[model samples]
Target: MSTATVASAPPAPRVQKRGTPLAKKRQWRAAYLFVIPFFVVFITMLIVPLFYSGYLSFFATRLVGGTSFVGFDNYVKTFTDPLFLAGVGRTGLFLLVQVPIMLGLALFFALALDSGRVRGSKVLRLLIFIPYAIPGVVATLMWGYLYGQDFGPIVQVLSALGLGSPNLLSDSNVLGSMMNIVTWEFVGYNMIIMYSALRSIPAELYEAAEIDGASQLRVAWSIKIPAIRPAILLTVIFSIIGSFQLFNEPSLLRNIAPNAISTSYTPNFYAYNLAFVSQNVNYAAAVAFILGIVIMIVSYVVQLSTQRRERLG
Candidate 1:
């Protein structure tokens, strides 16, 4: 019998001691080096601006007084100003209607694509996501042209069918029209978020569901939906934030639907006009702070509700 001996491995190197003053100094320096840039940018871009805006919010800038601290008078005016109030109401309406529809379509598409039953899902996903890839300006312009009252392809097509072309840019219809455009623009973005969440779910869960003879719909509702609730909530919060910050689409569409989209059509629009057009930077700052508070409150409520439900589950 041949005797075989295994070679013993060399001892591993000792980890370098970290608590020595020089070592700690090096570590601290490295940490500072890494974080300094971040602090610089944050202070310059965010902290300074936010504090300045907050400071301005407390004062009112008038032609007679120049700049005077009025102590929440600007805030009070923000709540009372008819145009600002109307903008807030319009934004709320958009949020209530558009967010649900956008998230629903995104969820449906995500679920359908994740299901093994769908064929050519890659192609479909690419097609769906193409709109998101298009620049917001370009997408709005393309849709605006298509919605044109005179000689646009859609209008011409309707005319050929002997049906009068519906004015999508009309005051009564513009809000709904904007909803459709926004949904088309963002559904795929939300879908990507949801699909990624769906993919993270364990295959073991699906296998167990199948073994229990659960149908596709049953598995989706009882397992898939619950597993992806966080992602859905994430999309909902994002939609809420985006809905309130509504600017690009409305701003671009204003040219096409000036009557439908007034200067103060949305809070963001109102703020922009106040700051730049009307030269009311102080009041604009107040309006912006008010909107920020609303956003923060809504986001906190959503997160709190989600956490409570998760604990219950």
Candidate 2:
């Protein structure tokens, strides 16, 4: 008699094949195809130059045959350079004072626009945002001329009134002057962003607040501000980064106020001068990297502090 034998089921299908050279090769080919352009441009423009800068930073450039390795000498020189240190300090000061004021103005304007009480709101918004639409160079040039001591109508009018116009291009007033220009350019830009966020908020919340007899101010404080906190945070982060990366306005203004604004007025300006004007590409790279790191750290700190406050509340 033959024994009854049960047929065994075939093994379950493998979802991922292991040790398959053909699959591996196909995957590699796909990856390469997907990344070819990025690698090409990145290597050509960014990666190769970055590595070269890193290598160069170890050496001091010479007017003669070749450069010699000095090992952190460039970095040491950066810290000890009074001009560099002063630029850093001035940049930090702008970030601290101007960023907050600009963001606050943006927030206030956004809230006002969102309130729906103001007639001709669209026109007002457009007018406010027009400055941002202007090219930075053009805007700076126009404002620079307007701040001119001799040619400016403002100074002329003030003189006629026997009230001396403050020298906006002076060393003491240059920072404030720059701040005003930046605020004018960016307030409406940031306001538009915050307004979009405010519009996204659910109307039901406001309706409920009104039902509870909350005033407009109370609704704004208790609901609108809290609801749009993320957008506010985003604008603050962007403003902080922009403040640190300031160059064009200061650079253009430098020509007008060379005595007050040095070749290194802002970190970006300093880096630019180092790389191009002075031909110290290595030191410029170091300073560029340092500025990037500083901005990152400050952004992170702002996020942390805001998060802590939210948690506490």
Candidate 3:
């Protein structure tokens, strides 16, 4: 019987654990796999186009001579081109007027929401944000119709009231009208940025402010505004970029506003017209890069100023 007993199965082979280096290697591989898609798209869509455009900026394409490298000739021409210079100035005006009004309204709304005194704050916030959710093109078209002197609500109201309709589409008033539309579209987005920053502040600071009998205004001025300066700076930078990149509304409204919105109303508009309408892709690439450089410089200046302020503070 003892001799006939079945041999016990050999102990199962021990499973080998992955060593530290192997585990790290596997983790890195997975991380790289996750990142590869974004890198590919970024290079294909943004970086490659940017470099190609940069290369083109150094060359000039002529009707008779074809394309030839001209060093910084394109850059010099871009800086001196009257149309491009006018577009840059127009864009600067847009930034100066629209940015302040938009940011001011946004800050006000954010402060009101953070006050905790407004009724139905969530509903109000949602309503405020609805305009931003709309596509810029749609918003432009809707507002363009509203500004119409023909059958729009504004004209109808004025007619009913026996008052003459103000021409919002007129060259004299069109820039202001554009400002209003931009402000309406972006105020909420900026408000959300500020409100989020306000929300992130430590509750203890609020409590302490309250203990000192600080009013809502004082608390906001001293505690909230100072606390959210970085967020405000971020919004300022974003607004600056958006102001310079003012293409969609003007472009979409061009059909209805040919008299007011010129083909080169903004630097972006100029680049677009040059590339598509005039069939001047090379020079358009140059203008586009020049604007990009300007944006980069402005943004860098803003960030640098903020850094210096932080160091001083």
Q: What digit string (tens of lDDT, one per residue) describes model 2 on residues 108-197?
A: 988999999988999999988899999898888888999998888768888889998778899899999999999999999999999999
Instruction: After superposing candidate 3 on the true structure, give the runs of residues whose Cα lies further than 4 Å from its correct spot.
Output: 1-22, 156-164
Candidate 1 local distance difference test against the native: 0.89
lDDT of each: 0.89, 0.86, 0.88
C-alpha lDDT (0 to 100) for residue 281 of candidate 1: 91
Which digits, one per residue and each the tens of the lDDT, describe model 1 over residues 189-221?
Answer: 999999999999999999999999999999999
Residue-by-residue lDDT tens digits, candidate 3, 1-313:
2212222223233422534443345556766877999999999999999999899888877778898988888789999999999989988898888898899899999999999989999999999999999999999999999989788898789988989888888887888888899999999999999999999999999999999999888999999999999999999999989988999988987888798888889999999999899878888989999999899988899899999988998
lDDT comparison, 1 vs 2, better candidate: 1
- Looking at candidate 1, the ten consecutive residues that score lowest on lDDT are 1-10
